[model samples]
Target: MSYIRGYDPDTLREIVDLRECQERLDEIGPQRSLPALLERVWLLKVLGRLDEALVISEQSVRVARMAGTRKDLLRARILHATVLQARGALPAAMQELTTCAEEAEGAEWSGIAAFALQHRGKVSYDAGDYDEARTDFKRALFLRQDAGAADEQLESTLLAIDAADRRRSRTSVAS
Candidate 1:
C-alpha cells in the first residue's frame, strides 16, 4: 500500500480528511529513500505543508538524479514542478513542466509526457489562461490514450478539458 491513501488516483487531489493525511505522514516518519521521500512530499503538499513538501521534493529530485533512472528523474521533476505550482510559482512550474514534457515526448515516453502536460495544463488554468490549459489538456488526453493510460487517467483529463472549456466560456462572456 502507498504511504497515503484517499486521493484521486489519477489527479492526486485530496478526497479524504486533512487530518488523516497528517496522521499518515506522521506514521510514515522520515526516510531517505527516494520513493519514501516522494510519498512524503505528496502527503505534505496535500496537507498544505508547502514548505516541507518543497524541501522533500527537492531532495527527492536530487536523489532521483543520483540514484534513479531517467524516468524516475522525470517523475521527480514533475512532482517538484507541482510543488512549485502549489507555492504560486507559476512561471517556474510552467518552465519545468514544459521542459519535462518535451523531454518525455522526445524520449517517446508518452505516459510521462502526458503526466507533465496534465500538470502544465493545471498551472495554466491556475493562471487563468484557459485557452492554453485546454490545449495542453487535449494534447495530454491524446497522449494518455496512446499510452494506454488507465480509464481514471483519461477521465481526469476529460474532466479537466471540460473545466477549462467552461472557464474559457465564462471569461469570454464576462469580457
Candidate 2:
C-alpha cells in the first residue's frame, strides 16, 4: 500500500492526512530501507517538514545508490528533487528533475519518465515559466497515456496543463 491516500478537492492537490502519515511513520519505526525512507520523506514533505524531508530524501538516494536498482535510484533522486522544490530551491530541483527525466526516457521507462516530467512541469510552474511547464505537462500526458496510466494520473496531468494555460493567459492579459 502506498503512503499517499487521496487528493484535495479544492485544488486536486495531494492530501496526506496528518494522523495517517504519523501512524505510517511510526509503523516504519527506525527502518532504513529505501521504501521506508522514501515514505518518510514524502510524509514529511507533505506535512511541510521540508528540513526533515530533505535529510531523509538524501539518505534515500544514498541507499538507493548503494543497494537498489537504477530505477530505484532515479525514483529516489526524483523524490529528493521534489523536496528541494518544496523548499523553494527551484534551480536545484529543476536540474535534478531534468536529469532524471532524460535518463528515465533513455531507459524507456515511460512511467518513470512521465513521473519526472510531471514533477518538472510542477517546478516550472512554480518558477512562473508557464510555457515550459505546459510543454512538460503535455509531454507527461502523452507518456502517461502511452504507458496506460490510471485515470487519476491522467487527470492530474490534464489539470496541470489547464493550470499552466490559465496562468499563461493571466500573465499575458496583465502585460
Candidate 3:
C-alpha cells in the first residue's frame, strides 16, 4: 500500500480503496508495515474523521520507529502534524512540524522540509505569531519554488502570507 503525501485525497483513493483500506491494513499487520497504516490514516483524514486519523497516524509513527525507517517516521510525523493543525492544536502541531523540519533538513528532503515549514508557518499565523510565521512562510516559499511545485500552490501560500502581513500591519497601526 502506498501512502499519500501532501493533502491530496483523490489521487490517493486511486491507489487504494478507502472503504477496505482499514481491513487491508489489519491484514498487513502494524508491526511490519507502517506504510499501510499511514495510508489508512490518510484516508480517514480525507474523510474528515480527524480523531481516528490521529490515532492511526500516531500508531504509524510508533511502528515506523520500531521498524527503523526514518523516512516512514518522518512521513507519519508530518501527517500527524497536519491532523493536529486541523484540530486547532496549533502548539502541538507546530512542535511536530518543527521536529519534522529538522529531520528533513538532515535527510536532505527539501520538499518535505518545505511542507513542514509551510504548515508551521500556517499554524503560527493562526496563533498570531506573525514574525515567526513570516520567516517560516518565506523559507517554505523559497524551497517550494526551488523544488518546482505547482505554481498555484505556491501562489496560494504567498497570498496567505501577504494577507497575514497585512493583518499584522493593520493591528500594529490600530495599536
User: What is every candidate's alpha-carbon RMSD to the true fold?
Assistant: 2.9, 1.8, 6.0
Number of the predicted model whose TM-score against the real structure is largest: 2
Question: Positional deviation of 93 in candidate 2, in angstroms?
Answer: 0.3
Misplaced by over 4 Å in model 1 are: 1-13
> How would the candidate models be sorted by lDDT, starting from the highest?
2, 1, 3
Which tens-of-lDDT digit does each residue in 6-88 have in candidate 3? Answer: 33321111233555655654665554366677776766775567898899888888888888477777888988887888788
TM-score for candidate 2: 0.93
Better candidate number, 1 or 2, judged by lDDT:
2
Residue-wise C-alpha lDDT for candidate 2, range 60-133, written one tens digit per residue: 99999999999999999999999999999999999999999999999999999999999999999888999999
Over 4 Å off, model 3: 1-36
Compute the lDDT for candidate 1. 0.89
Q: Across residues 1-175, which tens digit of lDDT does each residue of candidate 1 receive?
A: 4433343533435465777778878877987898889889988888889999999999999999999999999999999999999999999999999999999999999999999999999999889999999999999999999999988778888888988888889899999
What are the lDDT scores of the predictions, listed in order? 0.89, 0.90, 0.74
